[model samples]
Target chain A: MMMFTKPHPAQTIRSSDAVFEVKDLGVAYGRDAASVQVVNDVSLSVGRGEALGVVGESGCGKSQTMLAALGLLPRGGRITSGQVLLEGRNLVDLSPREMRAVRGSGIALISQDALTSLNPAMTIGTQMAEPMIHYGGMSRSAARTRCIELLDLVGIPGAATRLASYPHELSGGMRQRALIAMAISANPKVLIADEPTTALDVTTQSQILRLIDSLRKELGMALILITHDLGVVAGVADRVAVLYAGRVVETAETETLFASPRHPYTKALLDTISQLEDEVSERLNPIPGLPPDPRNPVQGCPFNPRCDYVRDVCRAELPALADSVEGGRHPVRCHVDPFVGLSLTMASGGAR
Target chain B: MSAPAIQLKDVSVRFPIRKGILRRVAGEVHAVDSVSFDIAEGETVGLVGESGSGKSTTGRALIGLAPLAGGTVECFGRDLRALRQAHGALPRMSQIVFQDPYASLNPRMTIGETLKEVLEVHELAKGHDADQRVGRLLDDVGLRRDLAERYPHALSGGQRQRVAIARALAIEPKFIVLDEVVSALDVSIQGQIVNLLQDLQQDRGLTYLFITHDLSIVRHVSHSIVVMYGGQIMEKGPRKSIFSAPLHPYTSALLSAVPVPNPRIERMRPRIDVRSEPPDPSAPLPGCRFQKSCLFATEICRTSRPQLRSMTGRDPDHLAACHHMQEPHVREALSRAAQGAVS
Candidate 1:
């Protein structure tokens, strides 16, 4: 209903200054007719020291988009179209060996599960030093010294002794910190954290988020944080992108998105979550149905069935993502303007 | 008023920590220690805590799944142990739905078979009658009766959770231990399950022990709350009082750590400095279990364990285990922290 006119600090960065950008990225699985477009027409960018949050449910292809950018898609999964540009270099065109060289020092990833990510047999020191040695061309002794310093920077206590311990010996929080330290070992220009704190406790989750936020600032690295939790993104992300059915449904500055979400799906998502600051209501207004199965694709807008303000056009034609208001930075993919013709009664009522 | 539906008094649960090749009884790990609470009929008591805080253990102890080392668990004013000894099993009045619906449901069996097995085991119904009852159970949880013929792998996570809830309800239990039931579902689906749980509670007059680490969900569901840490009850009170003005430092810290979905409020909120990790369960400290992580810990907290006591200005039932809960400075600090004011 309203918009914040003030420009955010992250918004001031020009596109030329973007350290990492994914332009109209499309990823698919399987071959020909059997192929399922898991991510389609998705574009995102993060400037130096900026954090862009990609929020979506489990099957929305949030993870697959980043995996494509990393050139680590699973077997049978391939980039269908578009470019993954890291500092004006099109990573999609790079060869396997070249991509490997660009991975650690150019852009690094911190995945959700730390236990499985790190090698069990290898000591923490070994895993941390291997990346530094391979990417930075450092000697073994020097890499070991840097490993301890990185561990200390990520707030692991007794860092020197911890280097000798295995992954299983460390707690969940410590293991995550170790993974983060290793990710930033080569000081990449971009960092991608996918559901980094989903497995952790509330207290430990806060600590991890703070650590990641501070590291992004201190290193001046672009951050692409992918998660399903809005509260997590609210704390760390400067910009927020809401994804649905493998497409970007809405994108805006973090404050603007939360203050006044333009898309029907984004509005519904915000309503479904029970925030700590919100008054506990009698009943939650949950979106009535489940997300569409990607294999069995839906026609027109994928969210049309569940959307409260569904129109005939929404079911007939897919809406391209465009700026909602003239001269407004917020882009929404929807057939109808949610605020237009919205009655107070309809707004208060639950979805049909 | 009427005897509480479930009562736990000074309950303690311990598991042996065997050592060496001989499997000697080296020591014990107190999984639950001296925890006490009451759940009135048709009331929900939220058990909130970090992982390994013994919330699930407390739930298991109530249903006779875990062996109690000390104290008593009573159901409907009768001792649970006595009931178990007389009946050869705990009565069919209580049930539990675990966190992982996928793991809990059997993959080999169809959904129909799963519901039928529960009915047959309890001798609640027979062949034709079981089929009819199974349909109703699915309908009760808002699932299609045709879904009964499908296997667990075919159904979605939310649908599988509904099947799990249906199996729990087939026994016609008046009390259920929902251990992180909605934690596995997406945020939108979580609301659906929570609303379903609330609706079922009203229709059947069910009493629930809703255990979870998510604070907002707990705040929505529970009439009262219990905060546990390191196998001990840190605080217990009406939900309003606990959230509005928490007296225990651990409770305050736990609440503050929960991220608000709004960016403006989240950034302005003052977070209490919670030091290090949770306590080691094997070697719990002598005094306060939360002393190591608490910022306001003093010498008294190091030597003497503070028992749950009600403060002067709060509700009589509102209790906290903190030595300095009544002191002016500590109370002010905790209240300020709970109110999200910069101090």
Candidate 2:
């Protein structure tokens, strides 16, 4: 079930061919003593033309990890430590002035909620051109031409006329496309789309995903798709990273990760969502308890509270993201083997 | 045989499309167009659609929340609209649970106070007996009795949802409308809430009109499924048939659009791209409403609207509103199934 026949340490991939990489990244909110580090030592990379997905529940720090890399964290949110390297250039130490240069041209972000992400007062054309004029150093007329071309590229009909229309004038799908069009206006090397289609309809969702997939192919841009939906990640992502309480719990190629999850959290996440393919069971195997509060310091594994396969080791030592087998590159931070949880889950017959 | 717990017949919800400073009715907006379905006693009828497909409106109209322009809603052998008109208010036979647990619950009231208010308003329980019953309801939804003291903001999303369920259960309603109830929670928490609902349904023998955009949960919790598009019922059938074999093009497209969590299977599966924009509710196209997006749509489909007809030979409960029921796509799917069976 290996999608890419790949087994490289995420670091090796990051240090080597990665177009964008985040190493030992940490993010905190509030002051020093009272501050809570929500994102802790999270590392990830996306090879040029590769789609890497960061998936987790809310407050898992998946979004913060990416926002830190792009320097778009909310006010009061600070990058506590670590480096966000793009093509070997450290982005962490870059000043706000220098970071602004890299914001749209070096790396672009398509955030969730297109309605709010876009400026309500600006026309679609003006927003699309601002990125090009600022990052691409293009003249207003040239950027206007480029905007029209991008709108056409993103499959918006009557591209020239629609550019004059405001975001509110377009449908939900059209607004999302306009957002994507705006993000790629400067032709950045990396595109980070966070829950791009969560607000869209199922049919429209597939269209948006397909559009992103096609754009990645055509532009050869490194893609980081962040979402909580495993099904969405399974469709478009080359590799999958499962996050829990500000740390990576599992990282592997999509097919391998989905087929044989090593972490109990990953396995529970897989079993929790009811699939159309799966026969309707009497009850789903829900992992008990909520995600660990990021504000509270955790002892050992953060998932130990909810994990069915938790052992003494899970409670005593915080498992580092490490190779699971003698030669396996699939990294998993778990105290128990996959079978321990799988067999137990099966034996319990959907026991809570 | 017992009567169906909730039955909606030729239900159409329309709002006047107003314009200008005069606030005149220019045209009518068909929110729900002649949608019909029945929920058997202790049965679940999943009503699924995208945004603006009228699933929520249908659920609202069932409980007399959304004004129905036409058609009748009968709850346990009573005309719900007429009963509400005559009595000034219909008794709590049907209750609804909205998606946003935060907004649904009163922020000022504690969980205990909320449930107690429901009991008092409905005259189900009072005083010390009310507290005991509220505790039992809390237990039914898998929440601790002590949690009743906490306000909605103090509790987690899942806990607050369970309290909402307990509040609905407080009325002891025969029918419950779950409108995107689990859409706001996490995946793991969604599973927990679904299990609680299933357990509650079994224990209380309550009827459910489950409405949501998420099809997987619908398939999991529902005994029967109704696929709605463009404010119309495109397909309705037993869960087994609808999932295994779909007749309408829109139903098939909707099903295929959902990405499977299994990457290997998802990569190999065929996807039908519905390129057309979402159908406008204000101005629904003539003939087949899905014709704009349906790949198999032809001149015939564009010229004539199809009636919901039963599958004579297949499961008699299966019904699809499409002109080309005997199209080649079904045959091709069948042949593929045959090939699959042989291997």
Candidate 3:
């Protein structure tokens, strides 16, 4: 019986200090009658110099949660209910003009598709300098200098020479580095990277991960790394949050989460990699069934339909995240404890 | 070879690069540089490499999508060149599944019509029979029958890909070249589509030339793996042999860099550093193409070319192209840098 209550605030590793605190956040698109909730009752925090990996399948509300926090959800999307506290001030309470002021100055986002996210017609220098100009209120020459420094900081060689190059001219790895440099140019306290390395090859992916890891330490910046790659989370993230159907089903430290994942959905995701490694020819032990339509909402656990060990109570009442394994350090939202059948152990030293 | 489904013997695809107003041929970019491999019947051969490695070109050449400037492409004992001469083209044998599903499928046509087009082109079916077969093909690819009436825009990414797979099956082809088919899909959906492909391969006895940059999926699906670098085969062997005991430095680097889900292993594993940028195809290397970036390169390595050959004391299927592959020093270097981050 692992205790799964919210731990004392001090128990969390204050890598730098708390930078953002989100509580009972909900995001909806459009007005009341036309509203559609994309992210629901999600709560998360990013401590200074901490890398929190928010991982889930696509459309699992990881991106939407961060988007709500940043006030950047598309035209129709709005924060219906939530407390987004940045430096003890409520960001949701701010006016649009004030929120705009807080955006790049406080939080920056690196979108998944670098090609589309980046302005194609603009030179890398121009795009990189835009943040400094608007947020830092620097002159063109000063901003250009800062842009060159940023390009160099992110490991782009010959930054001065390459500043003239457009997004298309740079390679994928280079483009990502440039994007990271741009994101950090404003010296934002919180950085949200959505599938940052999904497009990169293995070799480049590791490089980018290392770069982000090192930069987080250097700048003492808090990070929310949203991705589908569990591999990326295992090595880098200090805290792990697993999302499914607009709800976070589990949260824990990286080591504890991997060693003893408590949620069935988490276990299934872990098993997927294990199966891949074991070279089993049979169909993957995937949680069968499509995600519930957001429009046609369901009651109780959203994953109940796909979970193998579903119970009657699980279908009728949503399980509150209770104490699980990891010495009562984390919480899990599942009917059965995940460790019952799993021979749970962290993979020992070798190629991962 | 027990009648290989497809074989490329010293095949090359070169495009003449023109410069200036006169458009004079300045040089030829050897996109596929005398690459050779074979896909046996009902066998899936995975071609893995970074961009510009010519994996896609090799796949395209097998299906006659790219013109071969040199060497031979023979399918089931029939020379494609001779067939082209006799029939003025090759058709309905090798179908390709491109990476981007949306770009591959016709936006205007419904899924039913897309499959119909494939059948009409190959003259496989017509009338009510054609309609019935189209629905069956969709079902074969794990897509719904109602999906046939929906346009590409209406379907999910995975559904559109199923439509592509359905169209590929419409020809009833023996060989299918899946070129990065699932790279664009979500990870969870990726597994579903990959499983579907594996099921289809087994049921139809299809031979696959699976081209992808994703080594993880390649390892799972391909029976044999070919690692390409700078348009040449760096290494090629049976999946187990190649994965567990890679001989080439390039292959060794590639396999180690693939991030496993387990954190401890990931942290402990050394990251192999391959070159950041792809090689310039137009510029011919003095010796081996990888020699410039390879840490093991010596004076001899830079002066002489290495042919793909088996390392002594290894299985004959395992082949690598490196002059120093059999040397103890080279092996030590490969193992030392094998798990390091991508170069």
Q: Compare the candidates by lDDT and give the number of the best one.
A: 1
Backbone clash pairs for candidate 1 read none
Q: Put down candidate 2 lDDT per residue, B1-343, tens digits, no spaces.
A: 5778888899999989889999999998899999888999998999988888889999999999999999999999999887998999978788999999999999999999999999988777899999999899898888899998989998889999999898888878989999999988888888889888888888889999999888788888898999998899999988878877777777777777787777766767666557687678898888998888876778988888899987667888899998877767754753343222111
What TM value does the first chain of each candidate achieve? 0.91, 0.91, 0.89
By TM-score, the better pick of 1 and 3 is 1
> What DockQ does model 2 achieve?
0.49
Question: On residues A157-197, what C-alpha lDDT tens digit does candidate 1 reach at each position?
Answer: 99999999999999999999999999998889999999999
The candidate, 1 or 2, that scores higher on TM-score is 1
For each candidate, the DockQ is 0.50, 0.49, 0.53
- Give candidate 2's whole-model lDDT: 0.85
In the range B1-343, model 1's lDDT, one tens digit per residue, is 8889999999999999999999999998989999999999999999999898999999999999999999999998889999988989988899999999999999999999999999999999999999999999999999999999999999999999999999999999999999999988888899899889999999999999999998888989998999999999999988888889888998888888888777887888888878988888998898999999988899998999999999996799999999988888887877777877211
**Ranking of all candidate structures by their lDDT, best first:** 1, 2, 3
Q: Which stretches of candidate 2 lie over 4 Å from their true place?
A: A1-14, A274-281, A324-328, A338-352, B123-133, B333-343
Off by over 4 Å in 1: A1-14, A274-281, A324-328, A338-352, B341-343
lDDT of 3 by residue, A112-202 (tens): 7788889999999888887677767899999988888888899998999888999999989899999999888878899889999989877
Q: What is the lDDT of residue B305 in candidate 2?
A: 88
